[model samples]
Target: MAVLLGPPALAADPAPPSAQGPAFIDWSGPYLGIEGSGGASFGQHTFHGTMIGGRAVPDFKTGDATGRNDRSRNATTAVGGLFGGYNWQTGPWLYGIEADVYGANLKRPVASTAPGLGYEGLDPEFSVLRAKTDLYGTLRGRVGVAFDRALVYATFGLAGADVRILATYPDLAGGGVASTRHDLSYLGFTLGAGVQLALTEQLALGIDYRYLDLGGGGRFGLGALPGAAGGPVSTRDASFTSHQMMARLSWHPAGLTPPPETEGTSSPDDRFSLHGQTTFITQGVPGFRAPYTGPASLIGRQVQSTTTATMMLGLKLFEGTELYYNPEFSQGFGLSRTLGVAGFVNGEAQKAGAPYPKLRSNRYFLKQTFGLGGETEDVPDGPNQVATRRAIERVTVVAGKFAIGDYFDANSYAHDPRVDFMNWGLWASGAYDFPANLPGFTQGVMVEYNRPEFALRAAYTQVPKEPSNDVLDPRVFERAGGVVEFEERHVLPVLDQPGKLRLGLFSNVGNTADFRQVVGLTQAGLFADINDAAAATRRPRRKTGFYVNLEQAVSADLGVFARVSANDGRNESLSFTDIDRSVSGGVSLKGTAWERPADTVGIGTSMNGISPSHRAFFANGGVGLLIGDGRLRYAPERALEAYYALSLNKILTVSFNYQLVVNPAYNKDRGPANFLGTRIHADF
Candidate 1:
């Protein structure tokens, strides 16, 4: 009974502190900044039940003969959104509050054995179910201590959420469906600690951790939800919580300059710098599904939850414009390196390390990769964290290109936009930087490709469909089709400044050429061969996508940029190919108000939408700000942003959101929301 959670879309923690400058308007003045981020969410729940009667029959322990309890569902979904806020500082103790709200998606499906709950007693076993969680905003307070080159801070706040509970029941004696829905309010608290470590006058490194407590929560029946067996049973509400940790290496907008007094004879080899960032995060969501009201065939629902993680390492080699790789280090800053090696690992799981009751939801990626393999790197969204653990997994290499371990196909655009981070595959990509004969803008082009695979893991300790089953034959791996993509970029001087244009082309080909289709029967006894239907076809599937971007400074406080992308996905199975495309564009604004210690303010926004789909037209965008000076740099951290997405056509959509960041998730199983929704991350 594995429960797949949501994607990593929203971070449970608030945004990071802003970088600052001066308080007055002189050579340097104080300024504010804002930012927003998005990712996949992978937190979820699960529940189970036994037949007590009805369609389960013979009173074999299935439950009531009325056919009121005996159904179940295993549900999972990929969700994402945006949030933003503002910040202001006076002295050492930078102080500010921000709010982030989400308007994206919340989906939770279920899987079950019992047709529905068969409640002959006051408490029904478990069967049909539904889980829905949505939130309005998170308000936070900030306080911190500052040292000459360092600062420590703490934050606290409340998150208001709008949640809905739904359960369905099937008629066993006859044929029909019964369902109920509940709308509720939830209150929670959050706390986090962070530190900034200054490495040089112009560079700094930092790490932060945040904890979120959603309190003891649950709905009616089972432990808290009502039992379908008979009368009302003592029930308790479900509770959810998360924790996150992040590290970053940052550079000031203004490059590091040497002291005027030592300018003349300063050493020429002393101006190099480097930085690194890593993160771990985790979180969970739990609840129950009811099946007693309508359809006599409906099965009862039970309790369930899921945990996941996201691990990333980013390296920055800051040298002068003419950057090159050092053979000794096998790494390059800006120049081409003869050869180099890099590592990338991403993992995810449902009902990770816990017990599966009855309710469950399966992710589409997991269903597509259950078997039929070519390589792990062919899946569109990359690899599931648990799948890369296979001893045979190895890095992929092609002429003039190098990829560490397994990689994702860069060209698979057909499924790119809908893919969730929770079930993401792993990838390793590398390319050589070419020497250019251009000036002002650093110009280089490299060709690269990736292979993305799919796989997942869940706890087998839970009760099996057949009692006495000790060793549950857990599904260790699955194969999804693969993709290949090529990318190229050239930086150019726009209005005497640096900007650039990037171009990419890709294709997704099913690696079933030499693969076999494999299917398994779960304890629940349902055919889990969903992946074989559309993915393992003898006909091939292909996808191609492209994008172009431009960035320029309109003023010290105004910047503008635009990007356009298009994708074509063709499935040969039905001799019917679906062409899906999308285009996005946006801008950025940056400047400082009273610059001191390098504090500054910034804002950015982007507009994106998909061209065609079976759904509707969609659009999304957000804004953000920053407060502290040189507090944290690089690390790709965003302070605040709000975005909205909506469906206009059967396959097109529009989205909007507002976001604020106080803290982020550290571990996949107990961290902040990633904006992507619920996610699962596993590691060896």
Candidate 2:
């Protein structure tokens, strides 16, 4: 079972003494932050016999009929969310009111073999019990003792959660499956204690433990099965409780105001910065012509959704050096778990596990910049950037865990998936096949030389240990990916509009199979499956590609963009999508003419193709990372997408979108699919 609520307050140690005494560190202000939690839950569900219409019904059984007991399972979950509070202090005593909301993924499946009432012999029945704790919130009162740098406290609160339980019996006596679903909005109680430590006036870190009891659990009727006599059975009692441990980081915006300047001390504004953004998307394909299907084909007439939250923290270590860290939480899944399309639909979706919430340290890196004595430009405060001025001609070096796409192949009109196009091929060069781990990230080093007219950038990154694996290869130098890009900025002669053209080349040396080799092995009967051929022929191979991107402002309220790319198709795609060649173009229009200046409309189209060898491999039932329908009738994959976004405010926007895809997975025998989507995004 899944449980939600934040941890309590108590400190492991007292705060260090200050020169001006405990009062010098005030515990009076408002603060906001995020927390991550992990723990296990224990609970059980019992079934009881029922008497309906003067007839007795048999109780359900688990394991064996002779030994009947409650169905129970222990679940471990990782949860995360945002929190805020205000505090006041009176001498050594502190009090506050805090609120928080979090989400978790916890579930269990049970099965058994039992004798059927209608059938003479034993029959197999299985049930999947899932508790989707989508959102949980708490309003609590805190009391603690402040010790200048640390606080020890206890908290009690009112907690609530939106929980749903889904149980399915797949093999009933009558032949079809039976299921019962319950949606619950529960109000509960929480109590706990923990400690917090202040690393600085504006930043604090804490850890705590808590206990939660949701309180509404008991026997309930589940409607009858088709051929059963007594109508549906009921569970005896089903309750949930959890003990959780959580870690939190808090920031006080007011505390960020610099204290009276002291000799040789840096200003607080220059030392630290924080920013965050969130996006929620719901997408569905109403229907498609699916004549045939395989393991990776997209399913029609299904809606799926996802939500992502990211917090960026940055510290200026020195005059020209900065360090940044991003903590991100993501929930939900893409259509068909993000498969079946070479140029996939959503860039935000990860090739990970089932649809569930997860927390990850997405990016951390150190950057150093050196001025090259040119004109300076003022940069605004944002994630990974400080509100400062920098030379137009400068050199920057960065190293650590990050995404290669974060710095390279950027376009003004089509780069950011959150604000621009959602298709992978449209936002990024489809044929580049950038190296990354399961969550689309990598450890790498990048260097850039920038000037007003042009910029040169290069990087070397670690590839996955194996194709599409979550872990990176330890032999990064031996199995690595590298890229170099040159960007030129210019103004259109007659229109006098700003534009940029970027040319980039990329190469990856990794353990990949050759499509031709696999096809030959399969044709010769040396291998029954292309995957076996790939395994047998796995060796270090070099894959190379090039791309050209163009972005131009056609008018004050209109922008246009285009991309062309191609990669060698001899070897298997080591990362990214399966396209060997790609071309995409699009235009964006602001709603100024319609008097809604904050609104935007966009239209785009793309065509993706594979080499003859690659197509032959798929036609023979070969599978790639993103596409492969067991078998194929080869054709180019083409897609058209359009969207309209309306801004509700400066911090929030909503958009409606549609996409039409032809020859999905490059298989002409399958679908020309249509998808509808809605997106809500917020940045602060």
Which one is best on lDDT?
A: 2
Native-vs-model 2 lDDT? Answer: 0.73
Supply the global lDDT for candidate 1: 0.28
User: Worst lDDT window (10 residues) for model 2?
Assistant: 1-10
What is candidate 1's TM-score against the reference?
0.31
Window of ten residues with lowest summed lDDT in model 1: 335-344
RMSD of each: 20.5, 10.5
lDDT of each: 0.28, 0.73
Per-residue lDDT for 1-684 in model 2, tens only?
010011111112333335223332466789998986433222222222322212333334333333234454445556778999998878768899999988776555432323443423434434434455667788989999754355667899988877666655544446776677777776888887656655455766665556677766655655553444335544544555555556677887676221221222223346776666666666788778887788778888776666666778888888778899998766556788788878777767773233334678889999999998968876666777755567889999999999988888899888877777888889899999899987888998999999999999999999987778888887987999999999999999988999999999999998999999999999999999888898789898999999999999999999999999999999988778889999999999998888767788999999999999999889888888888798988899999988888764344466888888898899998778888887766664
Mind sharing the TM-score for model 2? 0.71
Candidate 1 lDDT by residue in tens digits, 111-208: 23233345333124333445566553567766665433444567788866565656555543444655566566667886765554334333334443
